[model samples]
Target: MHRLLFALDPEEAHELTLRVLSLWSERGPLLEVPARLLRVEDPRLQVEALGLRFPNPLGLAAGMDKDARALGAWWALGFGFAEVGTLTPRPQEGNPRPRLFRLVEDRALINRMGFNNRGAEEVARRLWRFRERGLAFPVGVNLGKNRDTPLERAAEDYLRALQALEPYGDYFVLNVSSPNTPGLRTLQEGPFLDELLSQLRPATPKPLLLKVAPDLSWEALDQVVELCRKHGLEGLVAVNTTLERPGLQSPWAREAGGLSGRPLKGKALEVLRHLSRVEGLTLVSVGGVEGPEDVWERLKLGARLVQVYTGLVYGGPLFPRRVLKGLLKLMEAEGVRRLEEVWPPIP
Candidate 1:
């Protein structure tokens, strides 16, 4: 069944999956069908982070359900939580076609799909409806500046989207690291990030975090972490995607935009390990998390939570349940009592 999706264009396959999930989300009870089959409801998997309680530490990374179209479906598939959007203040068609590529041999995807969505207002309404179902699932919203918005006013775009979706999300992420938008990654730099955070931090009492790129140098990452603390943000989503192709085997590896999946594991873990040294910053790790061991590695290294995108695309619907179950077995072998006790208390 998953192979059938591989036959279609990457974006087309993604759209079809979302459409099916959206229909499933409409009938709230039907979600229970998949939930019973896929969800692993164990107290040991529960985690506390970003001022919210997650059923498990695993999550669906942002950019999967860009417009909040599949909340129930994600829950049914057994994710602990889900982050939706890379939404802008306005609706956008994004860049031209062939923007998403599958690096089959590399077990990866390269997408330059620039902030495509039906805008913040529409997404917020969808989220409101999702909330009305009262599923107890935590939903995060990732905010991005529109493609046409200049770098100077980038903070305004973020603030506008956050304002629109504030009440609807359990947490909000400032997405300044996507390579698809011209100069978007610049927002991760010292001056730009400091300015952006200053404008955004005070706007809401919700857990506000920043998403960063994997291409940053250690010095640059330090600057990002400093600003995040200075502005009183909650935590960070440790990576967006990589611009570097590394040692890819697929012909499309050279495509522009960001590269995700197996190749990103090394750098993503490197970034998470570096950030883990920081005392108060909560870390949500992503990139190349293909199995239970990857999730366990992040949690052990002080990442309070972890998310997956490319892994899910390749692993099919049962991936979350299988990984979570495997995580339990791994934890039992290591003598872990609970996810909260995975690491010593951060000072």
Candidate 2:
């Protein structure tokens, strides 16, 4: 199944995969057998962050289920939480086709998919439908501005999305970090960030998080961290797909877009470690996490939660379950029962 899916166009293959998950969602209880076998039910895996409880620390990252199509399936797949979207106030066609690429040798993906979705209203409706049936775990909405929206008016786009989806989301992510959108990363600068956050923060009912680019320097990152703190932001998702392409063995490596997967792990971890030093912020570690060991390392490094997207593409449906089991083993071996005890004391 994995091999066949990989052979098709990346976006098309992704759609087909979603369809499969949607089937599982419709059937509902059909997933119970798999869930029972795969779920790791340790009290230690339960995580309380952003005023909500996650059955485990691992979650599906944004961009995977952009439209909230299979919320139930993600829960059944054993993910503790799922972030849907990069959804905009208005629906976008996104960048031209062939925007998503796979570097199989590197176990990575590079995508310039510019927040393509059915728009905020559609996503909110989908969330409502999912919620009517009841959500099994926490869900976050990753908000983005439309491509044509000017930088000066960007906050309006985010505010609009926040208003539309707030009722259904457990948390909200203000995504100013995606490299594919024109001038989107500029929002990370202090003045723009402050302006954006100031407008939305007061009105936001849920825990608001800032998703930042990994390419930022320590100085730039410091500014962002401080800004998030000043604005009363609750959490940060360290390291979106990077613009910088390090050593690469794939022919498609030169293609333009953000690079995610193993290459991002080191930088993502570095950023996570930096953010963990600050008090009053929950850090969500993403990028290059592939297995139980990676999840364990992120926990020890001070990530309150870990998210996986590219890893899911490479690791398959059973991946999250395997990681949870691996986490259980690591926890037992270390003689720690709770995720809070896993982190090393900040120096």
Model number with the top lDDT: 1
Model 1 agreement with the true structure over 118-227: per-residue lDDT tens digits: 99999999999888888999999999999888999998999999999999999999999999999999999898999999999999999999999989999999988889
**What stretches of model 1 exceed 4 Å from their correct place?**
none
Query: Residue 47 in model 2: shift from native, Å?
Result: 0.6
What lDDT does the true structure give each of the candidates? 0.92, 0.90
Task: State residue 319's C-alpha deviation in candidate 2, in Å.
Answer: 0.4
Query: In model 2, which runs have C-alpha deviations exceeding 4 angstroms?
Result: 343-347
TM-scores of all predicted structures: 0.99, 0.97
Task: Estimate the lDDT of model 1.
Answer: 0.92
